[model samples]
Target: MNATEKFYLPVDGIFDMFTSLTSPSAVTHPVVQSAVAPQQHPKAPSFSKTGMGIIRMVKESWRQPMAHRSSSSSTGRQLSIERQAKRSVDLLELGLAKPKNCHRIVVLGAARVGKTNILQRFLGNDFDESYAPTAEDFHRKLFHIGGDAYQVDLLDAASERNFPAKRRLSILTGDTFLLVFSLDDRESLHHVRDMLDEIAAAKAKLLKLKHPAKVPAVICGNKADLTSPGAVTRSEVTQALGKDVTYFETSAKDGTGLEGAFRALAALGGLPDETSPSRHQLISLLSYQTLCISQRGRGGLRARGHGAPCAAMDPLARRPSFTSDLRLLLKSGSNKNNKPEMCHVQ
Candidate 1:
C-alpha cells in the first residue's frame, strides 16, 4: 500500500462518506471538501434556500406571452371563450342603449322578377343584375314616415323552390309581405295566386289568428317601367285574382312607387296611424260588390232572366270581412260588362 493510504483510523469507518447536493458551503467540512471537486461547485445561490425563487421564476415566465407580454391579463394564455363573452356583452349593451322599431318585410316571388331590385331601391344600395338564386337574404334600412322613425328589415327570401319546413318560418314571422311580380310578366301575376293559396294554407295549419290576413301582406308588381301599353291594368289583376287583394305597382329601375309602397306598408302595419285611416270596421266584401252591382241593377240585383245571381249576392259563399288599410288604385278601365270598374274600397 502507499504511505498516505496507511494512515487510517478505526473510527473513520464509523460513518459512511457524506457529500451534499443542497448547498456548496457544506464542503467546508474537511471530509466533504477532500472528497468533492472544487470546480464542480455551482457559483449561484444554493438551490435548497432558493427553491421558492426558482419556482417563482418559472411562474413569471408562464405569465408573459411567448411573443411579448402586452398587458396585465391580456396574454395568449387567457381563455378564448371568456374574451368572446365579454365582447358579446359589450355589443349587447350598445344595441340596447337605443331602442329600435324594427319591421320584418318578406319579399317573395319568382326569380328574375326584381324582388331584389325593390329591396335595393328602398335601401339606396347598388343593384346587381346577376342571376343568382336567393336562399333567404337579409337587408336593413332606417326610414322616417310622417315624422316617425322606423327600421325595416327586408328579408329577400328565395322562391317556392326552397320553401321547406326550415324556410316557412319567414312567411310566418313577417310583419308584412311584399309579393313582387313583374308588371310586364303576366305569368308572374298568375303565379302570385298560387303563392297566396300557399300562404293561406300555411296560416290555416299553423296560426289560429282572428284574421286570416294576420300578416299585412301586399302583392308588389315590380318592373313597372318594362310594361307595354295596357299590359298590367288593375282591372286585369282584379279579374285574374277574382277578388281584391292588397297590391302595389313598383319600378325598381327608375324608382317609381317604391317610397309609396313602403309608406303604404308602414301604414298597413297600423303602427304609424298617422298615415293610415281611422278605424273602419270591415263592412263586407259582398257589401262592396253589392254596392257596385246594386248601383247598376235596381232592387237587390234584379233577376236578369234565370241567370245565377252575382257571387256577392250568394250568401253561402259570401262571408265576413274586416277593414284594413288595403286599397286598390285602379287606372279607370271598363270590364267585359261595359260597366265602370268596382270602386276602390279599404
Candidate 2:
C-alpha cells in the first residue's frame, strides 16, 4: 500500500467502529444518530472493539495541551496580582507625605576608612565586620517634626572619589559633608586634605564668594579603637585639617562619638532639632501615622504623643541614578543665588 493508504488505515478502522456502534440494527438503541454516516465499503476492515480505545486516547492527547495552557495563564495572572499587592503594601508603609525640606549629606573618604561603618551607625545599624569596597551608597531618613516632614539623604562616596568630575558634582550638590580618615593611615589624611581643597574650590565657584568660607562640613578621624603607636596624633590631625573645621575622633567599632558628630552635622545644616538621632523616637510607619492623627486631634506637633516627633526609615532605599543626581544638582543650583555652569565631564 502507498503511504497515504497506510496513514488512512487506522482512521478508516475508527470510522467503521463508530458506524457499527450507531447502526440501526445494533443491540443498543437508546441513543439516536445525529448525522448520517459515510458509505461503508465491503473491503474495509471489520470494526474492532479495540478501535474505541484508540479514539479515546487520541481525544485525550488533544485535550492535554489546552488544559495545560489554561493552567499556565491562570498562574501568570495570580503572580501579577501578588506583585501588585506587594507594591501597595510597600507604599502604605513608606509614607505618602511630601517632605518640607531635604538635606543632602555626602560622606567622602578613601576606601576602607570605615566610612560605611560610620554611616551604618548613624542609621541605627550595628557595625559590619565584613569589609567591602563601595561604589556609591545612599540612605534616607525621614523625620516628622513640628508638623513637618524633613528628609536626609546620606551618600557614601567611596570609589567615586577617584573620578574628579563626579566627586566635584557631589561636593557642589552636597548641603553637608563628612570627611573621614583613619588614624592608622596618614596617606588617607592627605587624601582628606585634598578633598577639602576641592570642596572649597567647588563651593567658591558656585556661591561666587570673594573667598570660600568654611562650608558646612565635619572632619572625622575614624578607627580610634585601634592601638597603633604609629597612628597620627589628634593634635597633628587638628593642625593638618586646620582649627576652623569641626573635627571629631570616632570609633566605629566602639560606637563612640558618632552621635555627637551627627548632631553637629544637623546643626550646621540648619536642620530641625529633632533631626538629631537622640532627639526623636524611631517608630514604625503605622504607629507614626497613628501618633500624627492623635496629635492633630489634640494640637499640633508639640501635643501628647507628638512631643518627641516620629522617625521612619526605608530599609530598601537606594542611591539615585547618575542622571537623577545631576538633575538634583541643577535644581539645587537654580535655588541658590547663582546657577553653576554645566560642563562636560568625561
Candidate 3:
C-alpha cells in the first residue's frame, strides 16, 4: 500500500482501530477477509456497490477526526510559541526602559517611630512591639493583576543619622518616600521635616535641576494610640510637613489608617491601584505560581473576587544596590546611554 493511501478498515474492524487493535493484521474480524477477498470464496455473498461506498464513507469519517486532532495540536503549539515570544519582547523592552513595574519605596523616620510596624501592616503581618533597632530592611511585594506582575520594594532604613551618605543615596534612589513620625514625640516630627529637606536637596543635586523636583512622598503620623500631653497635634504636624504633602495618622497596633495611607502612596508613585494593601489578596508563593500558570492556560479565566492576588518575598533575599538604582534613575531620563557616577554609601 502507498504511504499516502488511506488505511481502509472493514466495517466491523473500523471500531477496533480505536480499541486494542494496533496493526492491520491484528484485525481478526471475518469482515476484514470479506472486504479484501470476495473473489477467493465462491460461497461468500458479494457486497453491492452501495455497501462498498458505505464502508469507504466510514473509513473517511474516522480519518477526519484524526486529522482534526492533529491540526488542533499544531495550532495549540503555534499559539504557545507566539505567547512566549511576545512575553520575551515585552520583558526586553521593559529592561531597556527605566522605572520598570517595580518601584522602590523608602521609609524614613526617627528611632522608635513605628516605621517598620507600618510597613508590616501594609504587608499583611501582625504588629510586633519589640523595640529592636533596625539597621536596614528590604522587602518586596509582588502583585499579580490583569495577567501581569508588578512589584513594590519597601526599604526600611535605620534611624541613625550617622551615615548621611547612605541616607542621601536612599533619597536619590527612592521612587517614593514614606516619612513617619510618632504622634507622641515632638522630636520625631522634627526628624521627618529634616528628611523632607534632605530628599529635596539630594534629588535636585543628583538630577542637576535648578528647581526642586516633585518627589512622591507620603507623611505618616504613627503612634496615634499614644496621646501624650506634649505630643504634636495634627494641625501642627500638617503645618510642619506643608499642607500640600499627603499625610495620614496611623496606629500600627490598631491597624487603622495604614490601608488608606498605602493606597495614597501607590497612587502618588504611579503604581497599579491593585498594589494597594486593601485591594489585593495575600497569597503564598506556591499559590501565586499556581494561579499564574492557570491564568496563562488557553481556557478562559475568571477573576477571583475584586482583589488582585499578591505575594511577599523574603525581606533578606535581595540586597539593595546603589549602582543599579543610579542606572535606573538615569535611564528614566532622556539620556539612556549616559554612564552615571556610582552612589557611594560610605
Candidate 4:
C-alpha cells in the first residue's frame, strides 16, 4: 500500500488484510479478530459480537474524502472576497475627481467705478473705502450651487489709454462682459460706446477663425448711490446703447442689486440654479435693479470728468496686463506683491 494507507493499517492482522485487498490477483477476503486476554474474559463474548463491529463501521465512514472537499470550498471563498474589496476603492476615487466644464466670467469696467467693490461684496461680505488699482488681468472664485461647482474669474485691467490693442484682447477672454459705467460721470457713460466697438472687433477675429460663440455683453450703471433727480436715467442709457442690451443700476456701497446681478450672470453662463428642477436653466428675466441712494454723499451728485487722458500706443508697447480688482482690494491692508490668482477651476 501507499504511505498514507500504511499509517492507517493495524500492526499485524490489519497489515496482512490491507496487502491482500490491494493485490489485483486476490479474490477471497479474510475476516479475523485478536484473541481476548484473561483480564477481558467477562466482556470477550460481547466484544466479539458488537465492539469489534462498531470499530470497523467507524473506519469505513472516515474513508470518504470529506476533509479534501472542505479545504477546496474555503480557498474559493477567500479569493472572491479579496476581489470585491479592490473594486470598491476604485469607484470612490472616481467620484472624488474634479468637475469638468467650469465656466470663467471676467468683469470689465473703468477705474474707480466700484468693480472691485462689487466683487468683494460677492466674495466677502465686506467693503473697503480705500483700495489700489488692479495689476493683474483676472481673479478667480468658486461657488457650489445646484449641486455643481462654478469658477468665476473677474478681470479688471488698468483703464489707461496707452495700450489699446492689449486691453482689447483682455476683454475678449471673457464669455460675458459686465460693462460698468458711473452714473455720476457723463464721460464714463460715453466711454461705453468705444468699449462695445472694441469688444465687437475682438469677437469678429474669433469668428473668422471658427472659434466658439461670441461673448455676451451686459451694461452696468454703477454708483447708484449717487443717483439723484437730475442724474442720467436708465432710459437714456438704453437710447444711447440699444434697447436690446441688458442693463442694471447697482450700488456697491449699500450691497444693493448684487445678488440678482450675480444670479442673472450664473443663469446666463448656463449654470444650473438651485431653485430650478431642470439640468440647464437659461436666465430669461433681467428686471432686477437697485434704486437706493447712499446717504454719505451729497443730495445732488456732482459729475467728475477725466483727470488724465489715455496715453498713445507705441510700436514697442508692452502686452496688456490684467489684474483682479478683488485681489487688489483683499491686499489693500497687507502685502502689495502677491500674485493675482488666475488658474481655471477645472
Candidate 5:
C-alpha cells in the first residue's frame, strides 16, 4: 500500500498487533484485508482522562522562569540569574522563606526491563525477585538537598508487550524522563527511540508551541549488574544517544546507581546537585540540627546514622545544597563530523 493510503483497522484487532508511529509518512495503524476504506474523518481514539491530565500537568509545570534576581554586579551573579531564568517558574524561591520545590520523573521502557525494580530500590530500599505486571503507578518521595524542599514523583509505566494504550499515554507526565532499557536485550533500546519520537509529538500537541522541548532526559541501562563481558559501555551509550540526555548504568537488584539516577533526574528538574554537599557543610548541618533537636527536648537521636528520623523531623534539618547545572547534553560522538560539546555543570 502507498504511504499516504488510508487503511481501516478492525475494532477487535486494534488492541493487538498494532502500534502507532508519530512520523507522518509512517504507518499509523495496522491494516486488515477485510477492512473498508477509512472514512474521511478519522475517528478519534478513546483517550484516558488520566493520561491527558498527566500530559497537561507536565506541560503546565514547564513555564517561563520568574525573575529571581533583578541585578548583581559580579559575573557569577549574572550567570546564576541567567541559569535560574531557564528553569520552570514553579521553582522560584522566596527570600529566606521555605524553598519551593517539585519534580516529576517518569520511567519507561520495554517489559521486564526493571522499571518497577528501579523505583522500589530507590524509594523503599527494597527489591523483589517476583515479576508483577503493572499498568501504571505513581509514588511521591520527599527529599532535602541543600536545605531546599524537593518533592519528587516517580511514575512507573507499564511496558509489558501488552501494556495498555492508556497507561503508556499517562507516562508523559514527567518533567524529566528515564528511558530504562535492559543491558541484555538490545531490542529494548529501540523502545527508547520510539518513545523519544512519541514524546516529541506529545509535547508539541500539549504545549501548542512550535519550539522544541528543553526537558532533560536520562538513558538508564538497567540490569547492568547482570551484564557480562560483551555488554555495552558508557562510551557506546553516549555515541548511540546524543544530545539532551545523560546515560547511567544501574542494577535494581543490588541498588547500584539507583540513588545517583534518582538524584540526577531531580537535578534536571532543578533539584540539589549530585556532587554537592561537601563533607564539612554536611557535618555542620547535622551538628546544628542535632543541637536544635536536643534543645527542643525531642532527643531520640543517636550519634551515628544520618538516616535516622531526626534528619527528617528536625526544623533545622535543611542545609545549603548547591544546584548543579546538569546540562549533560552530549553534542556528538568523536567519530561524528561535529566537534565535541563540553559537558558543563554550574
Candidate 6:
C-alpha cells in the first residue's frame, strides 16, 4: 500500500477497536428513553417560597447545561491515555530514582592563584605541566572526603581584575566555598578581601531565604611549598584571615598540605566522618584491594619472586608514582591528553 493508505489503515483499525470496546446499548438506551417520554411544557412559578428554595432552583438550573456539555466515556478514555503517556515519559527521564546526596563545593580565587590546580590535585590527583587559563566554569570527578560524596565545581576566572559579577553569583550558590590565595604572589593575597566580600554578599542573599544556615566558607592558602622562611609568613595569612575562618596551606606540586585542606573543608560541610562504616567506605575499601594486588601480591608476596626480600615487597617499590595510580582510579577514562591544568600567578 501507499504511505497514505498504510497510515489510514491503522487509524481505521483503531476506530473499529474503539467501537468494539464501547457498548452500543448504552447510547441507544438513553436516546430511546428520551423519545418515549411524553412532550410536556411546564408553566413558570408565580412566587418564590423561602430564600433556600430559590437558591436551590438556581443551582439546579446552572448545573443542567454543564452536565450536558461534559465528556462521555469515550472522550474520558482518550484523555486518560494521553495523560498516562506524558507521565510515563516524565518518569523515564527522571529515572524514578531518588537523587544521591551530593555536596556542591566551589573553588574561588583571583586569576592564576592555583585554584584550579588545587581542585585538580584533589579531584584528579595529577598536576599539569603547562598552565592554560579557565574561560568559564569547569568540573572534575566527584571525591568522597570524610564519608560523604561531593561534587566539586571549580570556577577559576581569567583575571582577578575582570571577575564576572554573574559568575560570583553562581559560585555563591554552592553549599561551601574554598577561597584560595597564592602564597608566592602578594597581589593575589591583597585581592582576598574583595573575594571574601563577594562571598559574603552571596551568603547574605541566601540568608534572606527560608533556610539561612546551609552555607559555609573556607580560606585556603596555596603554594605552601614556596613557604620557606622570609618568603610569605604564615603569621601574615593568619592575621589577614582572622581566627574564625578555616585556613589551610596547600601545595599542588608536592602534594603538601592538600589532604588536610580538603578534610577541613569536608568537616566544615558536615560530611560524615571517614571512620563511619558507610557504603562509600565499603566501596573505597574494595577498590583498594585492586591496588594491593598490583602493588603487593597475595600475602605480601613480591611480584618479582617469592624468595625476594620482605622490605623489597613494598607497594611503593612496584608503583613508583602513587599519584598516577590514584589518577587512574579517579579519572573516568585513560585519556593521555588529559593533563591537569595549573593556575599560578606570574
Cα RMSD, each candidate: 24.8, 13.5, 14.1, 26.7, 26.2, 23.5
Question: TM-score of the candidate numbered 5?
Answer: 0.47
How does each model score on TM-score? 0.47, 0.65, 0.64, 0.48, 0.47, 0.46
* Candidate 1 lDDT, 1-346, residue by residue in tens: 2447644423222122221335434545565445454546464336434654555565567567665746656554244433433321211122311233445677778778988777666554556767666643765433233223334456665653454643455555556778888787788888777777666655554443455544467778887777498468888888876556777787877777776676677666654532221211222333333233343344332222322211111112211111111111122223557664443221
Clashing pairs in 5: 146-319, 146-320, 146-321, 147-319
Worst 10 residues of 1 by lDDT: 319-328
Candidate 2 structure quality by residue, lDDT tens digits, 1-346:
2345432335545545565764446433222222223435443334434556677777677678875655777678656545543321222233433433667899989888999989878777789899988744878776778775567888887668568787777777788899999999999999898888878878876665688657788989999999999999978887888888898889999977887788899888877767766678787644554554555566544443335566866555677667876776666556446765564233
Clashing pairs in 6: none
Q: Rate the local accuracy (lDDT) of all candidates.
A: 0.52, 0.71, 0.68, 0.51, 0.53, 0.49
lDDT of 6: 0.49
Candidate 6 deviation (Cα RMSD): 23.5
Shift of residue 295 alpha carbon in model 3, Å: 3.5
Candidate 2, 52: how far from true, in Å?
Answer: 31
* 1-346 per-residue lDDT for model 6 (tens digits): 2345433323334333334323334323343335323533232122212333555566578668975675688567556545433321111122221123334566667777787777766544477767878643444223233222233334443343454654544444456778888888766776775666666665554344443333377777777777455455668876776666777777878877777777776676665434122222223322332333333334331232322111101111121123442343334222358753221111
Q: Give, for candidate 2, the lowest lDDT window spanning 10 residues.
A: 27-36
- Candidate 3 residue 171 Cα shift, in angstroms, is 1.3
Compose the digit string of candidate 3's lDDT tens values, residues 85-175. 3321221233311346667799998888899889888888889988788854877776676656566778876554687776766776788
For model 5, the run of ten residues with the poorest summed lDDT:
319-328
lDDT of 2: 0.71
Scored by lDDT, model 4 comes in at: 0.51
Better of 1 and 6 by lDDT: 1
Model 4, 1-346: lDDT tens per residue?
2345423445344534534433445335322222112243554445444645555666666666564566767667655544433332111122311333244456666677777887666555367788787654445443333222234455565454467655654555556677777787767777776677667766565444354333477677888887477677878898787787677888888866666676667677665443121222322111000000111122311222212111111112122234542333234323346743332211
lDDT of 6 at 213: 37
**Shift of residue 46 alpha carbon in model 6, Å:** 99
Candidate 2 regions off by >4 Å?
Answer: 1-100, 286-307, 334-346
